[model samples]
Target chain A: MRETLRYVASRLATTFLIVLGAMILLFALSALVPGDPATALLGPAATPEYVQRFIQEMGLDQPWYRRLFSFMGNVFVGNLGTDVLSGQPVTRIIANVLPYTFILTFSSIGLAVAFGVPLGCYAATHRGSLLDHLLAFVSVAFIAIPSFVIAIFLLLIFAIWLDWLPVMGAGEAGNWFDQAQRLILPTIALSVGWIGFIARLVRSSMLETMGENFIRLSRAYGLSNRLITYKYALKNACIPTLAVLGMGVGRLLGGAVLVEIVFSRPGLGRLMFDAISTRNFPVLQGTVLVVVLIFVLTNLLVDLSYAAIDPRIRRQGSR
Target chain B: MNPDLPMITIRNLKLDARTEHGPAHILRGIDLEFGRGRIVGVVGESGSGKSTLVSCLLRLLPSNIERLEGEILFDGIDLLKLSPSDMNDWRGRKIAMVFQDPMTALNPLFTINTHLRDVLKRRFPQISAREARERSLAMLTKVGISDASVRLDAYPHQLSGGMRQRIVIAMALLVEPDLLLADEPTTALDATVEAQIVDLFDQLRQDFSGSIVFISHHLGLVAELCDDLCVMYGGTIVETGPVAEVLARPRHPYTRALLDCEIEDDHGGRLATIPGEVPSATWAMDACIFASRCAHVADICRRGPTVLETVAIGHKAACKRSREVLP
Candidate 1:
């Protein structure tokens, strides 16, 4: 227990340092971009004197190091700076979009697991069969195309061509059912790639497990085929697949950005995009910081879960 | 004929399997019989089809295998004729197998109790949970596991290699199978543990009325533990005899070579290795499989697949020159 605690403490400390470094980089990189925030916020029609006045008033002309220290201090105390474009708190903007991105990421991951794990197991069990070959072909095809292409295709098929789902917005209207329906297309787009990767991972892992000595022993014991595949083989196969699934969470975040853009959902990806185009430096910094934090935290969760799933980890931890 | 049938009778069992090269003839027309309460040790070098023969008995050969001809008669029933699902019921109930590597034999995810419970439940569905626990503990104790009740909650990983093997033995015997197939069960354990497991098998024989087919590459272990010994070479049983008689006089050249290679001491002297590899089963061999490596090879020894002719009471050898070869 103590060893696991020590391990987790060390990991969390490293993640904190990384988040700190990332935030600094986000601030520095945003600052280095060749654009005056005041001029961008004021638009091309603003008089030169007024632009200069606005820059001074907003403290855009402050020394980079000084401004950085202040921003860091505020962020340390849970204060992301206010947006120059809307004059609203950056945290509030993130708060509105963060939930949608979370929903998109998690739901897609759920969808990926729902389809990927079973398909992979099926391919493994029915190796050399037509179904196995078809699954293999589908995984390779899905993996080859980028998430955005899948997003566009799904949008075209379900929204434009089929008229089965709404083409725009995360339906924050009507009932909970409507909201869930709105998410379906975006979730499918984000998950298709993940499902392919996870299924392939599961298939290969399961094949290896099926060949293991314990599986043969299980068979020798007269275990039902169902018990052997679902209980014995799948249990072992899923350990490695769990790590892959966790990694897919972070990968899904990247894909979710493209998916959100295609679906026109109010998510972190869309927020980041709008912030970048308008040069909304504060909102951009806040969004990037939140994304990094989520990535680090999820990885920590993944690491901790290893100890729970495999007792060998716990035994090693105790040692 | 005796009123009670033999526990197992394998007749002209031939097995071939697909390999990278071609179909490998693994088991070639094997004939074997053993009665209840007897321990038959199958001793052979690698690729001699000792393990393959056991797999054929269980009908658990790899998917690539093609059974050319065989009838595994267990208690007068033809196991070869049973459907796959029917075979499943008879597998753990009438017959069970213990593997060489106990670490991989038992599921790492399950507790010892769970492993025993699973077998017991299938065998005795009417038994309640409390009674099942008692039966599991009793089986563990029968296998000489100390603190059997406490050990029940432990996972396979928690136990040492020897303990795990014991658990596997316990699980196999929980259903009281009529025939137990132990494929080199002690090969993976230390010398002391191997000895202990062999002793456990002896004890198990008295307590449980079942036949055991123990396969191993260890000739000395087989000589000491088995009531009956069958020596195999190149996918054929080269000799079968009472254990004492075979050790006293091995008729087959391959069995003699295996007996010579048995380690007897920690001396720093050279250890013996059988000359040449066992013939690959993937190709057709028209000559004697052991002729290339046999020390006493002669012109007449090249005939394909020597027949097992009786050389003495209850002893048989495939060597045509057995009378001359015998010391």
Candidate 2:
């Protein structure tokens, strides 16, 4: 128990440092972009006097180091800066769109695991079958194609041709049924490649696990093939897959950016897209920081779960 | 349940594995029997197919098996004729196995409690979880494990190699199998632990009325623990007899050479080793398999296969010059 606590404490410390580093890096990169925030917020036609006052009020006139220090101070207290274009607090804007992005990312990953693990296990168990070969080919095709291309294809088919779902937007604000309807296309578009990737990963892992001595021993003991595969082999096989799934969250979030744009859904991706075009530095910074935080926390959870799944890891350093 | 009948009878068992370079003949025409309540030891060097014979008995041969022709008669039933599901039913319930490396044999993720419970449940599908746990605890204690209750909750990794092996023995015994195949069960343990395990088997012999086929490369262990001994060379049994008689007066050149290879504690010179490499399995079985390594190799040994000829009652050797080569 003490060992686990120590491990978690060390991991949390590292996560904090990583998030801090991302914050500094995001600030530096945003500052380097060749655009004046003051002029971008006010129209280019605004007078020089008005622009000067806007810059002063926003502390844009301060040196980069001082501005970064103030930004860090505000972020520590949950105060993401105000949006230069809309004058809304960056935190509130981010809060509104975060749920949509979370749903998209989580559901996509859930779908990937739900379908991929079983399919991969079936492929491995029935290794040389025609179905295995077909799944292999289809998975490779899905993995090779970009998510945006898949998103556009899905939009073209589901929205333009089939007319089974909505064409765009996050649906009506109050109706969850409409919101879920809008989610299907974007979720599938973002998840298809990951499903393929996870299936391939789990296939190889399960194949290797099946070859382990314990698995053979299980067979020698007369355990059914189904029981042995799922109970004995799959548990060990999933350890590696779990690690990849944790890292996959970040990649899925990135794909959601394109999927959100193609679907015209109001999410972090859409918000960040609009922010970039309008040179809204605060909103972009806030979105990236939130994404980084979620990534780090997801990895932390994966690490903790490793201990739960494999007792060897759980007992490490205790004896 | 006949007292006079042998537990298992293997007749002309031949197995070949498909390889990139055609078939590798693993077990060539093995004929043997395990008497009820007797412990039979099979000793051989690497690639001698001692381990493969165990897999064949379990009907758990790998997918690459190209040819498996034989009759494995368990009691009066022909195991070879049974369906796969029937074989599964026989396994654990009738025949169980102890593996070479206890470290890898038991699933690392499972607790000892789980491993034992699973085996019991599979053998008796209607068994309750509580009943399984009670049986597991009793079996662990019977195998000489201390604090059996606490050890039940411990995972395989939490125990020593010897302890893990004890648990494996417990699992095999939990089903009260009629025949147990132990393939080099002590090769992975240290000497002290090996002695303990051998002693455990010795103790088990008194109560475990079933038959045991113990496979190992340790001649000393075989001599000490086995009632019957079979010396294998290149996938064929070269010699078989009462362990004392075989060790005392080995009738085959290969058996003589194997007995000679055993190092004495008081020896001062370099250790003795069999001169030639083990014969490749791909070679056609047209002659004596051990001819290359047999110091008394004659022209006739290379001409045709030699079948086991009786030297004494219950004693046989697969060498043409068994009488001439008697030491």
- Candidate number of the best DockQ: 2
Alpha-carbon interface RMSD of model 1?
1.2
The prediction achieving the highest lDDT against the true structure is: 2
Model 2: CA > 4 A from native: A31-48, A63-65, A317-319, B265-269
The RMSD of every model to the true structure, in order and in angstroms, is: 3.0, 2.0
- Residue A143 in model 1: shift from native, Å? 2.8
Tens-digit per-residue lDDT, B101-192, candidate 2? 99999888888888888889999999999999999988899898999999999889889999999999998998889899999999999999
Q: Which candidate is the best by TM-score?
A: 2
TM-score of chain B of 2: 0.96
lDDT of 2 by residue, A265-315 (tens): 878877877887877778888988888888999998998888777888867
What clash pairs does model 2 have? none
Q: Using alpha carbons, what is the TM-score of model 2?
A: 0.96
Residues B53-143 of candidate 1: C-alpha lDDT, one tens digit per residue: 9988888888887555878898788888999899988888888989999888877776778777777777777988889899889888889
Instruction: Report per-candidate TM-score of chain A alone.
Output: 0.87, 0.92
TM-score of chain A of 1: 0.87
